[model samples]
Target: MVGRLVIVTGGESGIGAACAQAFGAERARVAVYYHSDKDGADRTADAVVRAGGEAMTVQADVDDEASVDHAFTTVEQRWGVADVLVNSAGLNMSGVTVREMTLAQWQRLLDTDLTGAFLTSRRFLNGRGDRTGDAAILHISSIHAYAVRAGGADYCAAKGGLSNLVETLAIEEAPRGIRVNAIEPGMILTPMNAKAQEDPVYRRTLEQNIPMGRAGHASEVADLAVFLASDQARYITGARIVIDGGLSLMQALGA
Candidate 1:
């Protein structure tokens, strides 16, 4: 990925930040996008530079089309068209049941998780304007896309839609040499799971359900993301790669 242009949304922290650093290590030019965390984004950009790559931070609200467009525009103006895009900006579930989930909550999640992906992907492809190359789009999805949870109706539904979006885009853009794929991650040691990281007892109880007896790390997912966006993963598109250390596998073990 040396000299390639890589854009990672939500790159301020967690999986997104890890991806930024990983790509930076590969010597790619990185544009770290953050919603409202400029300080975090700056730190991530520093990590990228320390990893032997050039980087800059851009402000972007994934849920807002104008904001997303402006972010991409800034990158395009600074560099050329993006060679790779990592959509990681998203909101966690509210843990509210369908009966209790407000319409506002549902819209908020969908806007950031699902519609955001759509807008960014569309803008990216349109920006290319028939210029075909070995570009890639990686959507940081979740296992909840298929695996249901008690109070995750908003989140699960959005991810489920994202899975299909990735597949459809993959097929549509395959001939253009643009790969679109989804990474459905399970429990990971990120801010999204702060309680797990803060309380060992709670984390242990959660890990017990995972066959691997542990939660995945952000860096681990970043490694997978780098591979998927590299020549090493050429011809591997339209796939949902899961990296949960067998957490999803135990769902029906005793059923």
Candidate 2:
């Protein structure tokens, strides 16, 4: 019920867009960040407006410090300060073994997924006008952080690092009255994985692995983000909430 100001990186589409919509439904003012898809970001902003919330679209590459700084500056100028930040910007790479993976591939994943979070969060914490209570940073991590995929070494490493990074941030920022947490989502239906969804065999295989016997929807992850940002989760910090429909649990069984 709090109409707080919030920032959602990669808000152009996927889970980020869904999170924006969820916050909008609660009438939170949102700053939507998009890297390449201006059209998608605009549509997301429109949806927020339709939900009776205020929204503005900002263009920036999360990995670039200057761009990240500018985006936050723009938000600060317009809204003064934001209370919530959802770092959902990331890049996924599929390739051969560690030996076959080039330095560029590893760097790209780290830059986008890991470094991007650091850059964006650092800018916000330094420039944010509001340093009050109940502020949260929700990093969108992946189950790959714990579970390994053969060709996804770079992605897994970056996510694993981010998972630990959030935990450290939570402990360090707790005294500052800032809360930090992460969400590790399993196979969710989004444009990023639209092709995988179309493959019957792969989709079925993925569904069978989940105890829920289905992939998650973007809205489901968004609901978790909303709850974490709300006062209801005030006591929740330094926690990595998994919304993978028991996929991780199954991994433990195999281990």
lDDT (C-alpha, whole model) for all candidates: 0.95, 0.90
Which pairs of residues collide in model 2? Answer: none
lDDT of 2: 0.90
**Candidate 2 lDDT for residue 245:** 90
TM-scores vs. true structure, each candidate: 0.99, 0.96
Candidate 2 lands at a TM-score of: 0.96
Residue 251, candidate 1: alpha-carbon lDDT: 73
User: In model 1, where do residues sit more than 4 Å from their true spots?
Assistant: none
lDDT of 2 by residue, 1-255 (tens): 457898999999999999999899999998999999999999999998888788999998999999999999899998987788999998875567898999988999999999999998888788754466668999999989888889999999999999989999999888778899999999898987887678978888778988999999999999999999888898999999899998888876755
TM-score result, candidate 1:
0.99
Error of 1 at 47 (Å): 0.3
Error of 2 at 163 (Å): 1.3
Which candidate number maximizes lDDT? 1
Residue-level lDDT for 203 in candidate 1: 97
**RMSD, candidate 1, Å:** 0.7
